[model samples]
Target: MKTCILTTDTYLNHDTGQGHPERANRVTVIIDHLKKLKSKDLIWKKPTKFDLEYLAFAHDKNYLDNVKDSFPKQGLNFLDGDTIVSPGSKEATRDAVGSILTAIDGVMKKDFNNAFCAVRPPGHHAEKQKAMGFCVYNNIAVGAYYLLEKYNLKKVAIIDFDVHHGNGTQDIFYDNEKVLYISTHQYPYYPGTGKNSEKGKYNNVLNIPLPAGTTSEEYLDAYEYVLKKLKEFKPEFILFSAGFDAHEDDPLAQLKLKSEDFYNLTKRTIRAAQLSSKGKVVSILEGGYDLNALKESAEMHVNALLEF
Candidate 1:
Protein backbone atom coordinates (compact mmCIF):
# COMPACT_ATOMS: atom_id res chain seq x y z
CA MET A 1 0.00 0.00 0.00
CA LYS A 2 1.00 3.63 -0.51
CA THR A 3 1.90 6.12 2.18
CA CYS A 4 -0.79 8.75 2.71
CA ILE A 5 0.01 12.45 2.91
CA LEU A 6 -2.63 14.57 4.68
CA THR A 7 -2.45 18.38 4.33
CA THR A 8 -4.38 21.42 3.21
CA ASP A 9 -3.66 24.81 1.68
CA THR A 10 -5.19 26.48 4.73
CA TYR A 11 -1.97 25.83 6.61
CA LEU A 12 -0.39 28.66 4.59
CA ASN A 13 -3.05 31.01 5.92
CA HIS A 14 -2.40 30.27 9.61
CA ASP A 15 0.12 33.02 9.95
CA THR A 16 2.39 33.60 12.87
CA GLY A 17 3.85 37.12 12.68
CA GLN A 18 6.78 37.94 10.48
CA GLY A 19 10.27 36.76 11.59
CA HIS A 20 8.68 34.08 13.73
CA PRO A 21 10.40 30.71 13.43
CA GLU A 22 7.30 28.54 12.84
CA ARG A 23 6.19 30.15 9.63
CA ALA A 24 4.08 28.80 6.74
CA ASN A 25 7.22 28.18 4.73
CA ARG A 26 8.01 25.13 6.82
CA VAL A 27 5.08 23.19 5.33
CA THR A 28 5.61 24.82 1.96
CA VAL A 29 9.16 23.58 1.74
CA ILE A 30 8.22 20.09 2.90
CA ILE A 31 5.39 19.71 0.40
CA ASP A 32 7.55 21.06 -2.40
CA HIS A 33 10.31 18.57 -1.62
CA LEU A 34 7.90 15.67 -1.38
CA LYS A 35 6.38 16.59 -4.73
CA LYS A 36 9.79 16.46 -6.35
CA LEU A 37 10.05 12.81 -5.45
CA LYS A 38 7.55 11.84 -8.21
CA SER A 39 6.72 8.64 -6.40
CA LYS A 40 3.54 6.89 -7.55
CA ASP A 41 3.17 5.52 -4.03
CA LEU A 42 2.18 8.94 -2.74
CA ILE A 43 -1.51 9.35 -1.86
CA TRP A 44 -2.33 12.95 -1.14
CA LYS A 45 -5.63 13.62 0.61
CA LYS A 46 -7.42 16.59 2.18
CA PRO A 47 -8.28 16.49 5.86
CA THR A 48 -11.79 15.52 6.89
CA LYS A 49 -13.79 17.28 9.54
CA PHE A 50 -13.96 15.28 12.75
CA ASP A 51 -16.53 15.45 15.49
CA LEU A 52 -15.77 17.50 18.59
CA GLU A 53 -16.10 14.34 20.65
CA TYR A 54 -12.84 13.08 19.18
CA LEU A 55 -11.06 16.15 20.51
CA ALA A 56 -12.97 15.96 23.78
CA PHE A 57 -11.51 12.51 24.29
CA ALA A 58 -8.19 14.17 25.06
CA HIS A 59 -9.03 17.83 25.90
CA ASP A 60 -11.47 19.51 28.22
CA LYS A 61 -14.64 20.91 26.63
CA ASN A 62 -14.06 24.32 28.19
CA TYR A 63 -10.63 24.49 26.65
CA LEU A 64 -12.07 23.70 23.23
CA ASP A 65 -14.65 26.44 23.70
CA ASN A 66 -11.92 28.88 24.69
CA VAL A 67 -9.86 28.14 21.59
CA LYS A 68 -12.94 28.62 19.43
CA ASP A 69 -13.75 31.94 21.09
CA SER A 70 -10.13 33.14 21.07
CA PHE A 71 -10.05 33.66 17.32
CA PRO A 72 -9.77 37.33 16.41
CA LYS A 73 -11.45 38.68 13.27
CA GLN A 74 -8.67 41.14 12.37
CA GLY A 75 -5.47 40.98 14.37
CA LEU A 76 -3.33 38.26 15.94
CA ASN A 77 -4.07 36.87 19.41
CA PHE A 78 -1.78 35.00 21.76
CA LEU A 79 -2.71 31.74 23.43
CA ASP A 80 0.56 32.01 25.31
CA GLY A 81 3.85 33.80 24.88
CA ASP A 82 4.70 31.63 21.90
CA THR A 83 1.41 30.33 20.45
CA ILE A 84 -0.34 32.88 18.24
CA VAL A 85 -3.70 32.74 16.50
CA SER A 86 -5.22 34.71 13.67
CA PRO A 87 -8.69 34.62 12.13
CA GLY A 88 -7.68 31.71 9.96
CA SER A 89 -6.05 29.80 12.78
CA LYS A 90 -9.32 28.21 13.87
CA GLU A 91 -9.79 26.16 10.71
CA ALA A 92 -6.03 25.56 10.41
CA THR A 93 -5.78 24.19 13.92
CA ARG A 94 -8.90 22.08 13.54
CA ASP A 95 -7.55 20.76 10.28
CA ALA A 96 -4.30 19.85 12.00
CA VAL A 97 -6.18 17.69 14.43
CA GLY A 98 -8.61 16.47 11.79
CA SER A 99 -5.83 15.41 9.44
CA ILE A 100 -4.53 12.95 11.96
CA LEU A 101 -7.97 11.51 12.49
CA THR A 102 -8.34 11.04 8.77
CA ALA A 103 -4.90 9.48 8.57
CA ILE A 104 -5.74 7.06 11.33
CA ASP A 105 -8.98 6.15 9.65
CA GLY A 106 -7.14 5.49 6.43
CA VAL A 107 -4.63 3.26 8.15
CA MET A 108 -7.24 1.33 10.11
CA LYS A 109 -9.29 0.82 6.96
CA LYS A 110 -6.23 -0.46 5.11
CA ASP A 111 -6.35 2.45 2.68
CA PHE A 112 -2.68 2.92 3.41
CA ASN A 113 0.06 1.26 5.37
CA ASN A 114 0.88 4.53 7.08
CA ALA A 115 0.33 8.27 6.75
CA PHE A 116 2.10 11.60 7.35
CA CYS A 117 0.32 14.80 8.34
CA ALA A 118 1.99 18.03 7.14
CA VAL A 119 -0.26 20.44 8.94
CA ARG A 120 0.76 23.50 10.97
CA PRO A 121 0.35 25.07 14.41
CA PRO A 122 2.58 22.18 15.43
CA GLY A 123 1.01 20.27 18.27
CA HIS A 124 3.02 18.44 20.90
CA HIS A 125 3.13 21.10 23.58
CA ALA A 126 -0.55 22.01 23.89
CA GLU A 127 -1.96 20.66 27.12
CA LYS A 128 -5.58 19.83 27.89
CA GLN A 129 -6.38 23.35 29.13
CA LYS A 130 -3.69 25.56 27.56
CA ALA A 131 -1.96 26.13 24.27
CA MET A 132 1.78 26.76 24.29
CA GLY A 133 4.98 26.33 22.28
CA PHE A 134 3.46 27.24 18.93
CA CYS A 135 0.93 24.42 19.29
CA VAL A 136 -2.82 24.86 19.34
CA TYR A 137 -4.05 21.26 19.78
CA ASN A 138 -2.35 18.09 20.88
CA ASN A 139 -2.68 16.38 17.49
CA ILE A 140 -1.11 13.01 18.19
CA ALA A 141 -2.65 12.77 21.62
CA VAL A 142 -6.07 13.39 20.17
CA GLY A 143 -5.44 10.75 17.55
CA ALA A 144 -4.32 8.25 20.13
CA TYR A 145 -7.48 8.95 22.06
CA TYR A 146 -9.53 8.42 18.93
CA LEU A 147 -7.87 5.06 18.37
CA LEU A 148 -8.68 3.97 21.89
CA GLU A 149 -12.27 5.18 21.81
CA LYS A 150 -13.23 4.30 18.26
CA TYR A 151 -11.16 1.22 17.43
CA ASN A 152 -11.08 -0.19 20.93
CA LEU A 153 -7.35 -0.59 20.80
CA LYS A 154 -5.97 -1.83 24.09
CA LYS A 155 -2.56 -0.17 23.98
CA VAL A 156 -1.18 2.59 21.79
CA ALA A 157 2.40 3.87 21.74
CA ILE A 158 3.24 7.53 21.16
CA ILE A 159 6.87 8.16 20.21
CA ASP A 160 8.14 11.72 20.16
CA PHE A 161 11.64 12.53 18.89
CA ASP A 162 11.53 16.27 18.95
CA VAL A 163 14.54 18.07 20.39
CA HIS A 164 12.30 19.58 23.03
CA HIS A 165 10.30 17.33 25.32
CA GLY A 166 6.58 16.77 24.71
CA ASN A 167 5.43 18.04 28.04
CA GLY A 168 1.84 18.44 26.99
CA THR A 169 1.51 14.94 25.57
CA GLN A 170 3.03 13.57 28.72
CA ASP A 171 0.57 15.59 30.77
CA ILE A 172 -2.45 14.25 28.93
CA PHE A 173 -1.47 10.59 28.95
CA TYR A 174 0.64 10.30 32.08
CA ASP A 175 -1.88 8.33 34.09
CA ASN A 176 -3.51 6.49 31.19
CA GLU A 177 -2.18 2.94 31.05
CA LYS A 178 -3.72 2.35 27.62
CA VAL A 179 -1.22 4.76 26.07
CA LEU A 180 2.53 4.45 26.35
CA TYR A 181 4.15 7.85 25.81
CA ILE A 182 7.88 7.74 25.06
CA SER A 183 10.02 10.75 24.26
CA THR A 184 13.70 11.42 23.59
CA HIS A 185 14.47 15.09 24.00
CA GLN A 186 17.19 17.50 25.06
CA TYR A 187 17.49 17.87 28.80
CA PRO A 188 17.00 21.18 30.64
CA TYR A 189 15.32 22.69 27.57
CA TYR A 190 12.19 24.55 26.68
CA PRO A 191 9.15 23.94 28.92
CA GLY A 192 11.54 21.66 30.95
CA THR A 193 9.29 18.68 31.79
CA GLY A 194 10.68 15.42 30.48
CA LYS A 195 12.68 14.14 33.42
CA ASN A 196 13.54 10.44 33.63
CA SER A 197 11.93 10.08 37.02
CA GLU A 198 8.54 11.42 35.88
CA LYS A 199 7.24 7.95 35.08
CA GLY A 200 3.46 7.84 34.76
CA LYS A 201 0.95 6.50 37.27
CA TYR A 202 1.00 3.16 35.50
CA ASN A 203 4.63 3.45 34.50
CA ASN A 204 3.45 3.81 30.92
CA VAL A 205 5.45 6.98 30.24
CA LEU A 206 9.14 6.46 29.44
CA ASN A 207 11.36 9.49 29.04
CA ILE A 208 14.95 9.34 27.80
CA PRO A 209 16.54 12.70 28.32
CA LEU A 210 19.69 13.49 26.35
CA PRO A 211 22.21 16.22 27.07
CA ALA A 212 22.96 19.19 24.89
CA GLY A 213 25.38 18.69 21.96
CA THR A 214 24.30 15.06 21.73
CA THR A 215 25.58 13.48 18.54
CA SER A 216 23.69 11.11 16.22
CA GLU A 217 25.24 7.98 17.72
CA GLU A 218 24.34 8.96 21.26
CA TYR A 219 20.82 9.88 20.20
CA LEU A 220 20.30 6.49 18.57
CA ASP A 221 21.72 4.75 21.60
CA ALA A 222 19.18 6.50 23.81
CA TYR A 223 16.42 5.46 21.38
CA GLU A 224 17.09 1.85 22.35
CA TYR A 225 15.08 2.43 25.49
CA VAL A 226 12.07 3.35 23.34
CA LEU A 227 12.41 0.22 21.22
CA LYS A 228 12.88 -2.00 24.26
CA LYS A 229 9.81 -0.67 26.04
CA LEU A 230 7.70 -0.79 22.88
CA LYS A 231 8.58 -4.43 22.38
CA GLU A 232 7.50 -5.22 25.88
CA PHE A 233 4.23 -3.30 25.61
CA LYS A 234 3.32 -4.62 22.15
CA PRO A 235 1.03 -1.75 21.26
CA GLU A 236 -1.94 -2.25 18.95
CA PHE A 237 -1.12 0.97 17.12
CA ILE A 238 1.94 3.21 16.81
CA LEU A 239 1.95 6.98 16.47
CA PHE A 240 4.96 9.23 15.89
CA SER A 241 5.03 12.85 16.96
CA ALA A 242 7.61 13.42 14.26
CA GLY A 243 9.70 16.53 14.86
CA PHE A 244 12.75 17.44 12.79
CA ASP A 245 14.02 20.19 15.08
CA ALA A 246 16.74 17.92 16.43
CA HIS A 247 18.62 18.22 13.14
CA GLU A 248 22.05 19.80 13.39
CA ASP A 249 20.89 22.84 11.42
CA ASP A 250 17.92 23.59 13.66
CA PRO A 251 18.33 26.74 15.74
CA LEU A 252 15.95 25.62 18.48
CA ALA A 253 17.92 22.91 20.33
CA GLN A 254 21.43 21.55 20.72
CA LEU A 255 21.00 17.95 19.47
CA LYS A 256 23.13 17.20 16.42
CA LEU A 257 21.02 14.58 14.59
CA LYS A 258 21.48 14.72 10.85
CA SER A 259 18.78 14.19 8.22
CA GLU A 260 19.91 10.61 7.64
CA ASP A 261 19.56 9.91 11.34
CA PHE A 262 15.83 10.52 11.01
CA TYR A 263 15.70 7.82 8.35
CA ASN A 264 17.46 5.42 10.68
CA LEU A 265 15.18 6.30 13.59
CA THR A 266 12.06 5.93 11.46
CA LYS A 267 13.30 2.68 9.96
CA ARG A 268 13.85 1.21 13.38
CA THR A 269 10.52 2.46 14.65
CA ILE A 270 8.71 0.84 11.71
CA ARG A 271 10.41 -2.43 12.48
CA ALA A 272 9.11 -2.20 16.00
CA ALA A 273 5.66 -1.65 14.55
CA GLN A 274 6.04 -4.84 12.57
CA LEU A 275 6.49 -6.82 15.73
CA SER A 276 3.85 -5.01 17.75
CA SER A 277 1.17 -3.38 15.61
CA LYS A 278 1.13 -5.03 12.18
CA GLY A 279 2.74 -1.95 10.59
CA LYS A 280 -0.01 0.39 11.76
CA VAL A 281 1.70 3.76 12.21
CA VAL A 282 0.59 7.35 11.90
CA SER A 283 3.01 10.31 12.00
CA ILE A 284 2.11 13.90 12.68
CA LEU A 285 4.39 16.90 12.22
CA GLU A 286 5.32 18.57 15.52
CA GLY A 287 8.36 20.92 15.38
CA GLY A 288 11.15 21.97 12.99
CA TYR A 289 12.01 25.58 12.22
CA ASP A 290 15.07 25.84 9.98
CA LEU A 291 13.65 25.61 6.45
CA ASN A 292 16.35 23.44 4.91
CA ALA A 293 16.66 21.21 7.90
CA LEU A 294 12.89 20.80 8.15
CA LYS A 295 12.59 20.03 4.48
CA GLU A 296 15.39 17.49 4.32
CA SER A 297 14.40 15.80 7.55
CA ALA A 298 10.73 15.62 6.57
CA GLU A 299 11.67 14.06 3.27
CA MET A 300 13.85 11.54 5.00
CA HIS A 301 11.04 10.70 7.43
CA VAL A 302 8.48 10.14 4.65
CA ASN A 303 11.02 8.20 2.62
CA ALA A 304 11.49 5.78 5.45
CA LEU A 305 7.73 5.45 5.84
CA LEU A 306 7.30 4.69 2.16
CA GLU A 307 10.22 2.31 2.14
CA PHE A 308 8.62 0.29 4.89
Candidate 2:
Protein backbone atom coordinates (compact mmCIF):
# COMPACT_ATOMS: atom_id res chain seq x y z
CA MET A 1 0.00 0.00 0.00
CA LYS A 2 1.08 3.56 -0.64
CA THR A 3 0.53 6.93 1.04
CA CYS A 4 -2.24 8.96 -0.59
CA ILE A 5 -2.34 12.73 -0.83
CA LEU A 6 -5.91 14.14 -1.03
CA THR A 7 -6.43 17.65 -2.35
CA THR A 8 -8.50 19.77 -4.74
CA ASP A 9 -8.24 23.02 -6.68
CA THR A 10 -11.32 24.33 -4.88
CA TYR A 11 -9.03 25.51 -2.08
CA LEU A 12 -7.76 28.23 -4.40
CA ASN A 13 -11.24 29.76 -4.30
CA HIS A 14 -11.48 29.97 -0.50
CA ASP A 15 -10.26 33.56 -0.33
CA THR A 16 -9.76 34.96 3.17
CA GLY A 17 -9.40 38.56 2.05
CA GLN A 18 -6.37 40.69 1.15
CA GLY A 19 -4.00 39.33 3.81
CA HIS A 20 -4.64 36.35 6.05
CA PRO A 21 -2.39 33.66 7.47
CA GLU A 22 -4.77 30.96 6.18
CA ARG A 23 -4.25 31.59 2.50
CA ALA A 24 -4.50 29.41 -0.62
CA ASN A 25 -0.74 29.41 -1.06
CA ARG A 26 -0.41 27.29 2.07
CA VAL A 27 -1.70 24.26 0.20
CA THR A 28 0.03 25.34 -2.99
CA VAL A 29 3.48 25.17 -1.39
CA ILE A 30 2.78 21.74 0.09
CA ILE A 31 1.31 20.30 -3.13
CA ASP A 32 4.14 21.73 -5.20
CA HIS A 33 6.78 20.29 -2.88
CA LEU A 34 5.11 16.88 -2.77
CA LYS A 35 4.80 16.80 -6.57
CA LYS A 36 8.53 17.32 -6.78
CA LEU A 37 8.96 14.03 -4.92
CA LYS A 38 7.66 12.11 -7.96
CA SER A 39 7.75 8.93 -5.97
CA LYS A 40 5.55 6.02 -7.11
CA ASP A 41 5.04 5.29 -3.42
CA LEU A 42 2.96 8.48 -3.29
CA ILE A 43 -0.63 8.48 -4.61
CA TRP A 44 -2.43 11.68 -5.44
CA LYS A 45 -6.24 11.82 -5.46
CA LYS A 46 -9.10 14.30 -5.31
CA PRO A 47 -11.94 14.46 -2.81
CA THR A 48 -15.21 12.87 -3.91
CA LYS A 49 -18.78 13.80 -3.14
CA PHE A 50 -20.05 12.44 0.16
CA ASP A 51 -23.37 12.24 1.90
CA LEU A 52 -24.27 15.47 3.69
CA GLU A 53 -25.59 13.47 6.62
CA TYR A 54 -22.02 12.86 7.75
CA LEU A 55 -21.63 16.56 8.41
CA ALA A 56 -24.70 16.41 10.63
CA PHE A 57 -23.13 13.61 12.63
CA ALA A 58 -20.46 16.02 13.89
CA HIS A 59 -22.41 19.28 13.79
CA ASP A 60 -25.84 20.53 14.71
CA LYS A 61 -28.40 20.46 11.94
CA ASN A 62 -29.18 24.15 12.39
CA TYR A 63 -25.51 25.02 12.22
CA LEU A 64 -25.18 23.09 8.99
CA ASP A 65 -28.17 24.92 7.58
CA ASN A 66 -26.71 28.26 8.64
CA VAL A 67 -23.41 27.48 6.97
CA LYS A 68 -25.17 26.40 3.79
CA ASP A 69 -26.90 29.76 3.69
CA SER A 70 -23.82 31.81 4.65
CA PHE A 71 -21.97 31.63 1.36
CA PRO A 72 -22.17 34.95 -0.45
CA LYS A 73 -22.80 35.20 -4.12
CA GLN A 74 -20.19 37.87 -4.85
CA GLY A 75 -18.30 38.89 -1.68
CA LEU A 76 -16.89 37.12 1.34
CA ASN A 77 -18.96 36.35 4.40
CA PHE A 78 -17.66 36.09 7.92
CA LEU A 79 -18.63 33.12 10.01
CA ASP A 80 -16.62 34.55 12.89
CA GLY A 81 -14.08 37.30 13.41
CA ASP A 82 -11.32 35.34 11.71
CA THR A 83 -13.23 32.68 9.73
CA ILE A 84 -14.40 33.99 6.40
CA VAL A 85 -15.90 32.41 3.28
CA SER A 86 -16.22 33.63 -0.29
CA PRO A 87 -18.53 32.63 -3.13
CA GLY A 88 -16.29 29.72 -4.01
CA SER A 89 -16.08 28.70 -0.36
CA LYS A 90 -19.32 26.80 -0.78
CA GLU A 91 -17.47 24.25 -2.88
CA ALA A 92 -14.13 24.69 -1.10
CA THR A 93 -15.54 24.04 2.35
CA ARG A 94 -17.35 20.94 1.10
CA ASP A 95 -14.15 19.75 -0.58
CA ALA A 96 -12.13 20.28 2.59
CA VAL A 97 -14.57 18.12 4.49
CA GLY A 98 -14.84 15.66 1.64
CA SER A 99 -11.08 15.32 1.45
CA ILE A 100 -10.94 13.75 4.89
CA LEU A 101 -13.85 11.45 4.09
CA THR A 102 -12.19 10.32 0.88
CA ALA A 103 -8.94 9.71 2.69
CA ILE A 104 -10.70 7.70 5.37
CA ASP A 105 -12.41 5.51 2.77
CA GLY A 106 -9.15 4.91 0.95
CA VAL A 107 -7.41 3.83 4.14
CA MET A 108 -10.36 1.74 5.31
CA LYS A 109 -10.67 -0.13 2.04
CA LYS A 110 -6.92 -0.84 1.87
CA ASP A 111 -6.61 1.30 -1.24
CA PHE A 112 -3.84 3.02 0.68
CA ASN A 113 -2.06 2.55 3.94
CA ASN A 114 -2.57 6.18 4.90
CA ALA A 115 -3.50 9.58 3.48
CA PHE A 116 -2.70 13.28 3.91
CA CYS A 117 -5.37 15.88 3.14
CA ALA A 118 -3.90 19.17 1.98
CA VAL A 119 -6.88 21.43 2.46
CA ARG A 120 -8.19 24.73 3.78
CA PRO A 121 -9.89 26.65 5.47
CA PRO A 122 -8.23 24.54 8.08
CA GLY A 123 -10.49 22.79 10.59
CA HIS A 124 -10.10 21.89 14.35
CA HIS A 125 -11.37 25.30 15.46
CA ALA A 126 -14.95 25.13 14.28
CA GLU A 127 -17.27 23.87 16.98
CA LYS A 128 -20.50 21.91 16.54
CA GLN A 129 -22.48 25.11 16.12
CA LYS A 130 -19.93 27.88 15.68
CA ALA A 131 -17.01 28.53 13.37
CA MET A 132 -13.82 30.16 14.60
CA GLY A 133 -10.07 30.32 14.20
CA PHE A 134 -10.19 30.26 10.40
CA CYS A 135 -12.25 27.06 10.40
CA VAL A 136 -15.75 26.60 9.09
CA TYR A 137 -16.15 22.87 9.61
CA ASN A 138 -14.33 20.48 11.90
CA ASN A 139 -12.94 18.15 9.22
CA ILE A 140 -11.19 15.68 11.52
CA ALA A 141 -14.19 15.51 13.80
CA VAL A 142 -16.35 14.61 10.85
CA GLY A 143 -13.90 11.89 9.86
CA ALA A 144 -13.96 10.49 13.38
CA TYR A 145 -17.73 10.29 13.27
CA TYR A 146 -17.57 8.66 9.87
CA LEU A 147 -15.47 5.89 11.36
CA LEU A 148 -17.74 5.43 14.34
CA GLU A 149 -21.05 5.46 12.46
CA LYS A 150 -20.20 4.13 9.02
CA TYR A 151 -17.56 1.59 9.96
CA ASN A 152 -18.88 0.97 13.49
CA LEU A 153 -15.48 1.34 15.11
CA LYS A 154 -15.60 1.83 18.84
CA LYS A 155 -12.18 3.27 19.68
CA VAL A 156 -10.69 6.02 17.52
CA ALA A 157 -7.86 8.37 18.44
CA ILE A 158 -7.37 11.88 17.14
CA ILE A 159 -3.88 13.22 17.76
CA ASP A 160 -3.74 16.96 17.17
CA PHE A 161 -0.16 18.25 17.03
CA ASP A 162 -1.09 21.74 16.01
CA VAL A 163 0.50 24.71 17.77
CA HIS A 164 -2.92 25.88 19.01
CA HIS A 165 -5.49 23.82 20.88
CA GLY A 166 -8.27 22.05 19.01
CA ASN A 167 -11.16 23.43 20.97
CA GLY A 168 -13.79 22.33 18.47
CA THR A 169 -12.59 18.73 18.35
CA GLN A 170 -12.54 18.55 22.11
CA ASP A 171 -16.01 20.05 22.27
CA ILE A 172 -17.53 17.49 19.89
CA PHE A 173 -15.98 14.45 21.54
CA TYR A 174 -15.89 15.77 25.13
CA ASP A 175 -18.64 13.43 26.24
CA ASN A 176 -18.14 10.56 23.83
CA GLU A 177 -16.26 7.73 25.46
CA LYS A 178 -15.49 5.93 22.21
CA VAL A 179 -13.14 8.60 20.81
CA LEU A 180 -9.93 9.88 22.40
CA TYR A 181 -8.89 13.40 21.44
CA ILE A 182 -5.34 14.42 22.38
CA SER A 183 -3.77 17.79 21.66
CA THR A 184 -0.36 19.45 22.22
CA HIS A 185 -0.31 23.17 21.74
CA GLN A 186 1.07 26.52 22.91
CA TYR A 187 -0.43 27.60 26.22
CA PRO A 188 -2.02 30.96 27.03
CA TYR A 189 -2.21 31.40 23.29
CA TYR A 190 -4.89 32.04 20.74
CA PRO A 191 -8.32 30.47 21.46
CA GLY A 192 -6.99 29.64 24.99
CA THR A 193 -8.74 26.27 25.47
CA GLY A 194 -5.99 23.66 25.87
CA LYS A 195 -5.21 23.58 29.58
CA ASN A 196 -3.92 20.35 31.10
CA SER A 197 -6.85 20.42 33.47
CA GLU A 198 -9.40 20.76 30.66
CA LYS A 199 -9.86 17.05 30.23
CA GLY A 200 -13.02 15.78 28.57
CA LYS A 201 -16.18 14.82 30.39
CA TYR A 202 -15.30 11.15 30.03
CA ASN A 203 -11.59 11.80 30.69
CA ASN A 204 -10.91 10.78 27.08
CA VAL A 205 -9.27 14.10 26.18
CA LEU A 206 -5.64 14.87 27.02
CA ASN A 207 -4.29 18.38 26.71
CA ILE A 208 -0.55 19.07 26.93
CA PRO A 209 -0.08 22.78 26.96
CA LEU A 210 3.42 24.09 26.30
CA PRO A 211 4.46 27.67 26.73
CA ALA A 212 5.74 29.89 23.95
CA GLY A 213 9.39 29.53 22.78
CA THR A 214 9.30 25.82 23.54
CA THR A 215 12.35 24.16 22.01
CA SER A 216 12.27 21.20 19.65
CA GLU A 217 13.60 18.91 22.37
CA GLU A 218 11.00 20.17 24.83
CA TYR A 219 8.12 19.67 22.41
CA LEU A 220 9.26 16.15 21.52
CA ASP A 221 9.71 15.36 25.21
CA ALA A 222 6.12 16.40 25.88
CA TYR A 223 5.02 14.28 22.91
CA GLU A 224 5.92 11.19 24.91
CA TYR A 225 2.71 11.78 26.86
CA VAL A 226 0.75 11.81 23.62
CA LEU A 227 2.23 8.43 22.72
CA LYS A 228 1.51 7.11 26.21
CA LYS A 229 -2.13 8.12 25.87
CA LEU A 230 -2.38 6.61 22.41
CA LYS A 231 -0.91 3.36 23.66
CA GLU A 232 -3.44 3.29 26.49
CA PHE A 233 -6.36 4.04 24.21
CA LYS A 234 -5.34 1.35 21.73
CA PRO A 235 -7.38 2.90 18.99
CA GLU A 236 -8.56 0.84 16.04
CA PHE A 237 -7.76 3.69 13.68
CA ILE A 238 -5.68 6.86 14.14
CA LEU A 239 -6.19 10.32 12.72
CA PHE A 240 -3.75 13.21 12.92
CA SER A 241 -4.97 16.77 13.01
CA ALA A 242 -1.65 17.66 11.44
CA GLY A 243 -0.61 21.25 12.09
CA PHE A 244 2.84 22.69 11.30
CA ASP A 245 2.46 26.09 12.94
CA ALA A 246 4.69 24.99 15.79
CA HIS A 247 7.66 25.35 13.49
CA GLU A 248 10.08 28.09 14.46
CA ASP A 249 9.56 29.93 11.19
CA ASP A 250 5.76 30.05 11.51
CA PRO A 251 4.71 33.64 12.04
CA LEU A 252 1.45 32.87 13.86
CA ALA A 253 2.76 30.89 16.85
CA GLN A 254 5.79 30.69 19.14
CA LEU A 255 7.04 27.15 19.29
CA LYS A 256 10.62 26.44 18.18
CA LEU A 257 9.99 23.12 16.43
CA LYS A 258 12.22 22.43 13.46
CA SER A 259 10.95 20.94 10.20
CA GLU A 260 12.39 17.53 11.00
CA ASP A 261 10.57 17.31 14.34
CA PHE A 262 7.32 16.58 12.48
CA TYR A 263 8.85 13.42 11.05
CA ASN A 264 9.81 12.19 14.50
CA LEU A 265 6.42 13.09 15.94
CA THR A 266 4.58 11.21 13.20
CA LYS A 267 6.90 8.18 13.08
CA ARG A 268 6.81 7.74 16.85
CA THR A 269 3.04 8.01 17.05
CA ILE A 270 2.48 5.49 14.25
CA ARG A 271 4.86 3.05 15.92
CA ALA A 272 3.04 3.38 19.23
CA ALA A 273 -0.35 2.66 17.62
CA GLN A 274 0.70 0.15 14.98
CA LEU A 275 -0.32 -2.90 16.98
CA SER A 276 -3.96 -1.89 17.17
CA SER A 277 -4.40 0.64 14.38
CA LYS A 278 -2.71 -1.70 11.94
CA GLY A 279 -1.22 1.21 10.07
CA LYS A 280 -4.65 2.71 9.37
CA VAL A 281 -3.78 6.38 9.60
CA VAL A 282 -5.22 9.51 8.01
CA SER A 283 -4.14 13.13 8.49
CA ILE A 284 -5.76 16.43 7.58
CA LEU A 285 -4.26 19.90 7.52
CA GLU A 286 -5.08 22.11 10.48
CA GLY A 287 -2.78 25.09 10.88
CA GLY A 288 0.65 26.20 9.68
CA TYR A 289 1.21 29.79 8.57
CA ASP A 290 4.62 30.35 7.05
CA LEU A 291 4.80 29.01 3.50
CA ASN A 292 8.42 27.86 3.74
CA ALA A 293 7.88 26.26 7.12
CA LEU A 294 4.60 24.66 6.07
CA LYS A 295 6.19 23.21 2.97
CA GLU A 296 9.19 21.80 4.82
CA SER A 297 7.27 20.49 7.83
CA ALA A 298 4.54 18.87 5.69
CA GLU A 299 7.18 17.20 3.54
CA MET A 300 8.86 15.71 6.60
CA HIS A 301 5.49 14.55 7.91
CA VAL A 302 4.70 12.83 4.58
CA ASN A 303 8.13 11.25 4.39
CA ALA A 304 7.38 9.38 7.59
CA LEU A 305 3.99 8.34 6.23
CA LEU A 306 5.57 7.07 3.04
CA GLU A 307 8.25 5.11 4.84
CA PHE A 308 5.89 3.68 7.44
On lDDT, the candidate that comes out on top is 2
Candidate 1 RMSD to the real structure: 0.8
lDDT (tens digit, per residue) of candidate 2 on 71-158: 9999889998889999999999999999999999999999999999999988899999999999999999999999999999999999
Task: Give all TM-scores, in the order shown.
Answer: 0.99, 0.99
Clashes of each: 0, 0
Model 2 gets an lDDT of: 0.95
Candidate 1 accuracy as TM-score: 0.99
